[model samples]
Target: MTPEDLAPDVLTDAAAPIDPARVSDSLDHENTLKKDFVRRVRDCLEAGESDTVYDLVEPLHPADVADLFELLDADERPLLAKAISDLMGSEVFAELNDHVRELLVESLPAGTVADIAEQLDTDDAVAMLEDLDEHDQLAVLAEMEPEDRAAIETALSYPEESAGRLMSRDCVAVPEHMSVGDLIDFLREGHDLANEFWEVFIVDARHHPLGTCQLSWILRTPRHIALTDVMKRDQTLIPVLMDQEEVALRFQKYALISAAVIDEDGRLVGQITVDDVVHIIQEEAGEDVLLLSGAGEGDINEPIRESYLARVRWLIANLLTACLASFVIANFEGTIAKMVALATLMPIVAGIGGNAGTQTLAVTVRALATNQLTASNAWRAVRRELGIAVLNGATVAVVIGIAVSLIFGIPRLGAVIALAMLANIVIAGLAGVLVPLTLNRLKADPAISSSIFVTMTTDSMGFLVFLGLASISGLVG
Candidate 1:
């Protein structure tokens, strides 16, 4: 459609114009879009009132517009996009959830997708296209300008979740020889420079980064001073192949606003800003937790098939681990038959032990992710966790023992269970800390497999220890 086709028409009697001041009515106190507003949009879309839908959505922020798309039914998303096509700009697309954006992008023509891609930062653009199948990806790339195409193609060459794909190609880099006056003039004249940058990189003739000058420093420094004099000689330079999680860690560690990304030869290539790092931090944090639970991305928008596949494998693995736990219990069936209460109380020991293991696993995984628990302090972290586990075990065992003895009037049974609880909890703690550490040492994702192994250890051991004590202590008779 031509620009004229999208021009705002005068408000009709059928749909009155929305007052800007009343737009807050669309959102709740927490800034989430109200269900009533969503219902109104859905009603308009169904009624073929496209103009009213546009008016309702146009006043919302780009992020809100993206949220509205996600809130709508999948079938209705394209209709909303169609009605407010002019408002579906790069910012809205950038803010969109991956699955929702993919759905919209796939429905649009290749040229339209290309146009949206062109308007996005290189990182955001690559994110939008990387998930497309190769054929469709090539079609969109073929429609983009050569320079933009080259930038995206180069970014795609890097491994997924690497800094190369996350960094924006647009950054301000100037020769070190240039004076502050010359730099300012160049920035003023350089229409093609990056639209937003926190710092200006000073590079040598070969485009090797020498230092970085914050925009504030540049503005405050004397114009006649050499760029080198005002720039900080010590700066964190991100290697192109560094994992995006590591990049986020560096940003968090150094409190960086922006950092220059470098090639193998140490030449400046792209820059990663804090805004991009914010998204990386959130993604990695959520990914690790979901992976630990075997939940697979945990995004509600994720396709049913993909979510099912990701979760089923873990469930199957858990099933196998659970069989191992059952095997331990099978060996104690005679003892359980002798003492029927054993069946009632055994689950408490196993369940509490499993909870302890999970707590330790979470702390260890987070420490490993943040580089807090490395080889240097690995043993210290393990000992610290073990210490905490013992205290927790003792406290819980005392409470459960007193309650079981009073409730069942069997002091021997209570003593047996108390000892079993303590042993199982300590075992759980050891497994929790050691499993992830071993996985990390093997160059595997500690978060992915740690929970499976830890849960197996806790469940199997809890049953074995509790039942063995019951049998040997004569509590079963």
Candidate 2:
């Protein structure tokens, strides 16, 4: 549904309305949900006034409530959940952060979690259950209805992050034999159909998707018109095993509001809507940025041990790469000692190169993720980066050259460092583009590996070039 569809202060009649200003402030800023509100809720919970806690939360949108849950401490969640058990619904669960949701689910009984699963769509239900331990998963599944359990089981069997795990089973599908009138009547009469859908799928006898009929078309067309006459035969179908990122790209490329997800046999099993893909896009964008920094998952709700393990391994890897720069500096130890200026000026070279490399790395990784860069245009991408580097290097060299001459009172020393600066910047740009491209070619995650190699390349080269230039130019002596 669109943003215009929702009421600002309240969701339903049963939900006690909250101040619109509270929602407005929360929506406008990164963390506008004030501590005072949280403290008030805590006080209510502490005093065993569950009704007060419920009264405060009942009016907010499910998304807002989800945000509120994030603002609360982990210990406060169960208390809040207990205070508003009836008010908590599928919408709130669907809007929850994955890590936070998992914690809450773990705290609840298998049956309670199963009941929440039942309230969500098949894909969301699978998402909520798939993270639990296998034993716990079985227990939760056993507590679910046979139909819901079966759907979740099948989705879990597909690889994680695949379209099968991302698509909702709650879609309306009709045989092409039906007319508009028949389709409309079925939709009005069917009790088990999805409550929220933008369009309906038209299928053939084999249950393979043949076309799609948007809700608008159904309303506009005459009742006697056959489904095929109104349906758009051209549709983007997602393979069940296709990665969710690719699925989201397809949705964007086609401007599709919804698409059918099919199994290997070409029978439609589920559907992916724009709303589901929006979450995937946001998650992937954020996940990649965090991975680039070696910050695992970057979720506050992640277990401490898991966060430690994720970061420590990358730190160990970084230590090894840092040694490469140390090795370069070690070879020039005598030169540096003889001319203290060489030691003083060298860090500037490495620091600038590292920053340049990072700039290029960010752009290249983003291009690759967006499908803007690939084998076909990789050479062009490299050439474009090189041109940018040359310009950037020339600009940086002039500024540093003048500064060094004024600071050190040596024009030749300035020239020597200037040349080194230009060379290192060029190398930085090359490393930034090449490293990620190489990782991508090797079937590794470019975002995860690119930064380390790029940083190492820039650092090692930065030291090597600057020291070598000073030694060769005899400016240090």
Candidate 3:
């Protein structure tokens, strides 16, 4: 209809003042999902104005709304979910924090959860159910429609954190024999296609993925060309049993938006999208860092008892290592008694060495994780670390040497400590690189317990070298 034929009051309706309280500022660059928005939603909920709470949150992105769920107190999550039941779509659940999502899911009925699972991509649906107990999972699955139930059940049968568990079952795959025109027409006529796909997998008669045809290519190339002719032959296929972290690395290295996931027989079963890889990358990166500190998953929403259990066990292990350093100190009691300056300067040696080791350890673990450090080239990595250690040792030794000489007015003491510092720092670098590599060779995670062992080595050796030199040189006595 022409503008004149439209409703006479359209302009007036368009110009109506926005309700300040109901306005969604989610799109405004400045109006981020901060504490103020959270407080307003909380206030609205507390006042029993569930509709107002919904209005306040309706403008947020699914990820932002998920963040809002995290921002809420645990008790309030269910209340807010009740208030925004219609708004709690699959996207919101997909983006929700694992802990928060589980809490909400547990509060939901089996049928409702099944419905949500049905609405989500297979990977996300699997993630939602992955944490549930066998009984709870079965209940949810029983409530689901048969097709979705079968897809989820098959995915759950794979080991957790594997490509099979991470991939989306709803992929767009077509026979290789079709022409580009035929593929285009089929895609246009298909009603049950995946909501999101970057490329269409070209498959053989046996349903084995042969290659991929990117959407950009499909749209640009002439329709008369055979699908196999225009499709890229060099496509990365993810093994179903491959670890999720490896899956992410492959995505990063290959710059892939989506890759076909294959079974043992090399038959295409599902696809892993880049969006899921992003989550896996973030999880693995954080997991390694927390593991280095002996901290278990280090999730804030973790129960107090669970957090304590994860952290305290490591602290106890650290205590045992601390005693080994103490044993070295006890052996040098006479040396410290003769010159109290030895007592004052020993900790500086140990502390700095520990820090140096930690720096190297972090780098080594990351390189190993990214496949940058491997058996054939490990020696090269070691030599590079040794060079860095030498530079670090020289810098630290010179500064500490000058300070000791000036403060103690004993050149021999300074010389003893300077040489000791150099020895310990070089030892730190060696231990840092060697420990993680050893752990990796043993098929253990390099990040886990590496920090503790590295600290112990630095501390014990720091005490041994400094005290041994001080005793032998007769600088203190």
Candidate 4:
């Protein structure tokens, strides 16, 4: 009946809930540990207590160390990096955001940078080195071992952001003729292979990958069975020159844990793992979002000068577009003067249309990104959008029409505004979908300038429709 007696029964029940207060306390304790760890390290640095900082940071995971680096100020990052120089391993480098890693690499001596690169896999080493300045890159490359340097140089030669750069050269590969017993002996004989792999690729005499043998099959299959017998032939083989985004799509489409990377000669050169594809997916997804806003790689760690350079051009382009809308408004100055209400009500129509256009534009851009919208389905998508636009126009027209009539006590004015709203909304929807699609056809990035053109269309059309209708209907004195 007591708490101690109930503890045994609670432990036996798998689904028993823990105390809410206890759970909260545990979370708070973990958070406190993180904060205290950071503070103690900071205090150690300030007080010239080097050993204390080193001891405090020693137990943290690489990812947590990376987080701690980010939590520090710009001035503190270098200090922490210097303090935990030994602890700054390949895993910590892998966890860092690109901008932060670039900054850290730039700050470190070239020799020190090379030392870190040597400890990393080929893919991670290439990632760390590629962002450096040409001179710094050369200096670091000079310090690397001859073979490691050659492998990185070969990967770099294949083009930036390609599968060649993304793939690691370390992988378990076997000749297709090997039996399961032979494969197991090969694995057991302490071959220098990747630290982790989900599958072993079976290659032909010319080093061309023929098929794959999953680890599960290797473990369960009879030892006398040939690898060719158990291997799955329908494996995805990525071309070394393929874009990283395309590589990620292949992984996603095929649901693969690992895929072979083949060179021009169809020879297996490397392998792309799921972990690498996960990073590519995240990078590509974020890159698309930033590109949509005309913001290039909008990382918080980006240098102020670089951030300004990236964003200012977009702002300037927006300014030019705004002037075009202003010019359209100026042409209707006479109409605005004749009816003050025209000036007041005109903005509502244009503003609503711009918003509606942005909504459709965003959807279109996303569709293009995910490969859901292709030339084959373009017309069908456009038609679907047009139909939705018509429905939206009708629904909005009725509400705005009735409201305007009641507010102004002028049925004719209400009717004119309502028709204008309906027309603008329909145009907004059409322009939204068409502009991005057209840009995509022209081989331009659909997200980059779609918003600017879509806004221009909605604004110009909204103004022209409202003013022309008011002038034609004799609403303007």
Alpha-carbon lDDT, every model? 0.91, 0.88, 0.88, 0.83
lDDT of 4 by residue, 302-322 (tens): 889998998899889888888
Ranking by TM-score: 1, 2, 3, 4
Runs of candidate 1 exceeding 4 Å displacement:
1-19
lDDT of 1: 0.91
Model 3, residue 167: C-alpha shift (Å): 0.3
List model 1 lDDT by residue over 248-351, tens digit each: 99999999999999999999999999999999999999999999999999999999999999999999999999999999999999999998999999899999
lDDT of 2 by residue, 1-477 (tens): 221211122222254557887556435456445677778888998898988888777657887788888888887888887777776677888889888998877777776677778889998898888898899899999999999999999999999999999999999999999999999999999999997999999999999999999999999999999999889999899999999999988988889889999999999999999999999999899989998999999988788999999999999989999998999999999998988988888889999999999999999999999899999999999999999999999999999999999998999988988898999999999999999999999999899978999998999999999988888887756
Model 3, TM vs. native = 0.93
Worst 10 residues of 2 by lDDT: 2-11
Model 3: pairs clashing at backbone N, Cα or C within 3 Å: none
> Which residue segments of model 4 deviate by more than 4 Å?
1-40
Query: Which is better, 1 or 4, measured by lDDT?
Result: 1
Which one wins on TM-score? 1
Could you give the C-alpha RMSD of every candidate to the true structure, in order shown?
3.6, 5.1, 7.0, 9.2
Best by lDDT: 1
Error of 2 at 375 (Å): 0.8
lDDT of 3: 0.88
Using lDDT as the yardstick, the better of models 3 and 4 is 3
TM-score of model 4 relative to the true fold? 0.91
Relative to the unseen true structure, what is the Cα RMSD of model 2? 5.1
